[model samples]
Target: MCVVHLLDNPDSWAPASLQGLNLCGECNDQMIADLRLVAARWDDAQEALHAGAGGGGSERHAQRIEAPVPINVSVSDALLVARDNIWSVVLRLVDDHAVQLPVYQDTGSLAEWLSRSQAVKIAGSADKTFTKNAYWWIRDAAGWTVTATHGAETKVDLPDQFCKRPGCNAQLVVVENRAGAHIVQCSADAGHTVQWDTWTNMLKSLGAQKRRGPRLSKKRA
Candidate 1:
């Protein structure tokens, strides 16, 4: 049985109650609830695949692996649950769990990337890194730098707004703009740039609980 605990200050986005309590805090509870729902669907899909594997042929096995998981998620809910900080954490966790789809990496060209991400929407500023969906929402809100390499020339260009080096306060100056991909130099050393999916996976691994209670009622079973 799913338990719903209402927050004293209602965050409509969060679950009424969560699986545990130790980690329940101010803003992230809603994200935890959303994760639970999504995870439950994934588990159910896996179970169905297992159920269909009795004496199955190779074709059946292949189908199970390739078929889309039957998850009935609402886009609106997904958006609402994925608030500012909450969205980042969930997206990071998803990425960590290797659940991301194929999308272009940050190649320094927000416009070109936005063209590829037509299916998704970008909502926030380009200057500010947003979570999975949000990051794609407002592609041009903040200008990014482009670094490309031509046959013999290295070209770099900057958008109105550029990414600041990870630690250092210096702006990311674009040095090249190639047709396909580009590279830029920053004051700080290069760091691993994680995709939104990878970030979502990290949140899942947090192992934090928003609330706690018996998973099911003895009589319900």
Candidate 2:
């Protein structure tokens, strides 16, 4: 049977919760090895980040001059990034080899093919989620600033406020801005400006949580 292994670490592969597929022993071993390789790559990348952070040198100086210093991310974060990247390549492979292989056929051969493929080197979509220019820590300014590359660059001046709207619990952005003034109207929607406060007290009040209805007892007929 095809066994789903949890790709959480590099040492050993654990059986996943769901199970149902006919996979040979060799194929299963190949799948586990491929997953371990991916995990290893992620670990190496994280280690590189940590290694770069050590000591006084050109690299350290450069990092200091750079607005946001890149730090080593967690394994879970790396796993997520690897997962997305791997899936994208897998989907493309499936599309290209549609004629030869069935979509739901044994993934062991497919997994082996993927292991030797160049697509494994591709960076995940989440890799760009936190680019160097996206946001920065300004030591002199004493706060973080969104760079021009960020979608919210224009709204950077807006106070960090949460939406107070009952059902629409999305973050509220500054809809109206008064030049050279602290006063502004904030809302997720331009028309839904139900609350108004100074920039200082904008996030003072918290949004009310929605209460769940009581569970109904089973009727014994």
Q: Which candidate is the best by TM-score?
A: 1
The parts of candidate 1 lying over 4 Å away from their true place are 1-166, 169-172, 180-184, 191-221
Prediction RMSDs, each to the true structure: 21.5, 20.3
User: Pick by lDDT: which candidate is best?
Assistant: 2
- Write one digit per residue (lDDT tens) for candidate 2, span 1-221: 12212111223343432122223344334434644344333323333334344432121211222235454332222223333434444564455444244353222233334444422222111232211111110010001001100112123223344455666655544322222111122334422332122222222211111122332222111
Each candidate: how many clashes?
Answer: 42, 1
Relative to the true structure, candidate 1 reaches a TM of 0.20
Model 1, 1-221: lDDT tens per residue? 11112212133233322233212232133333333333223222223333333332221212213344332122111112212222343344355443453353221122233334421222222221332233322211111111100222242333332344344554333332233433343423222122223223333333233453222111100
